[model samples]
Target: MGRLRVASYNVHSCIGIDRRFAPERIAEALLDIDANVVALQELGWHHRGLSNFDQFAYLEKMTGYHVIQGPTKFHARAHYGNAILMREAAHTHQLMDLSWPLHIPRGCILAHTHWKGEPLVVINVHLGLTPWDRRRQLKQLVHEIQSHRNSHVVLMGDFNNWKPASVMFKPLSQLLPECTDQPTFHTRKAHAPLDRIYLSPGLRFDTIKVWHTPITAKASDHLPIVADISF
Candidate 1:
């Protein structure tokens, strides 16, 4: 058995609570978490003149981690969406579209990697805001996980789940234990459990917490959730 450190953060396009666009601060917050694998949401990639346009490349260089892009929206000169960074290389990875018509684009990154010779499947996602959208998205997500039942799974991201006890999350809870409960949104005085992590059966988490610190509190609108797991 081996342990793996995982983290999930919605960077709000690198715009902090102070209304500042600083990818450096986000990188610093990430360094503080020091997780082995990180799932990021709302990462912005735009042309020059914009704040930290190439956030993906910048964070990868700053944190010295292998970065994988999972953009849900692509523009003429910009892309926006989820991403994953890992200290170890992923054997395989793919972006799964979770976009619903009439709503903004959304997606998840499904990556196959290993920790200490044990195989792992990590799914990084950013669910939609509306309840109907989230319910459908959850159905699709559950189907995907069920297909990969043999592998140890880790699903983490900004679930956009405002109510911790909402029945909409029942399917996911039944499939994988919700690993964290600490509120991680509205960093100013976080009181919403929008950010979360879930683990498949046979995978056990030792400890999990919302990464709260001076830098993290202002790094983005949502704080990062970190967890240590063994399998």
Candidate 2:
């Protein structure tokens, strides 16, 4: 496969730092990134600020990409979680629950798609806040990656890992081996590498950076991280 561009963003429920709920702004940022596949976190459906409309639908329409939603929290009035937007069709997809009991619900979106006729497995996740919760969630994430050891895997998301040297990520470091430690949180003056991308062996990492722009800086709390990879 040739180079494929992928991006991960925490839309923060489409609420910007200015406290505005604008899905269009998020869509605009995604358009600017212009990635083949984008993994998004904190998408809301039927929420108050969103005017009770499905946020994913609006984004799908605006970005013109096929979407697969993995809702972790569901209620009578609201449903929100992670989702994947792909320029190409996904052969199959599923959701893996990573929720810690009594804590906010979390999940990962596992999507199977192709790039230049090669199978690519994309794992998109939004981890919990506490260290213990992230440790347990990472264990499950590693197991999932191991099961798909045969394919080209790209694991990208808001890992919620603030410490670049944290031992909690040791298992992932050993498995994926290559880690991008660029700051993506707090778009105004980012200092934490909370958002990251990991690749399976054999995939060449060409370039990676945080997609920072005027619109992205105000679109959400975290800026989008883009990466280009090939096999």
- Note each model's CA RMSD in angstroms: 2.0, 1.5
Per-residue lDDT tens digits for candidate 2, residues 35-84, read: 98999998885454564678888899998999999988677778788999
TM-score to true structure, per model = 0.94, 0.95
lDDT, residue 126, candidate 2? 91
Off by over 4 Å in 2: 45-48
- lDDT, residue 127, candidate 1: 91
CA lDDT of every candidate: 0.87, 0.87
**What's the lDDT for candidate 1?**
0.87
Residue-level lDDT tens digits of model 1 in 193-217: 8999899988888998888998988
Query: Which clashing pairs does model 1 show?
Result: none
Show where candidate 1 strays beyond 4 Å.
45-52
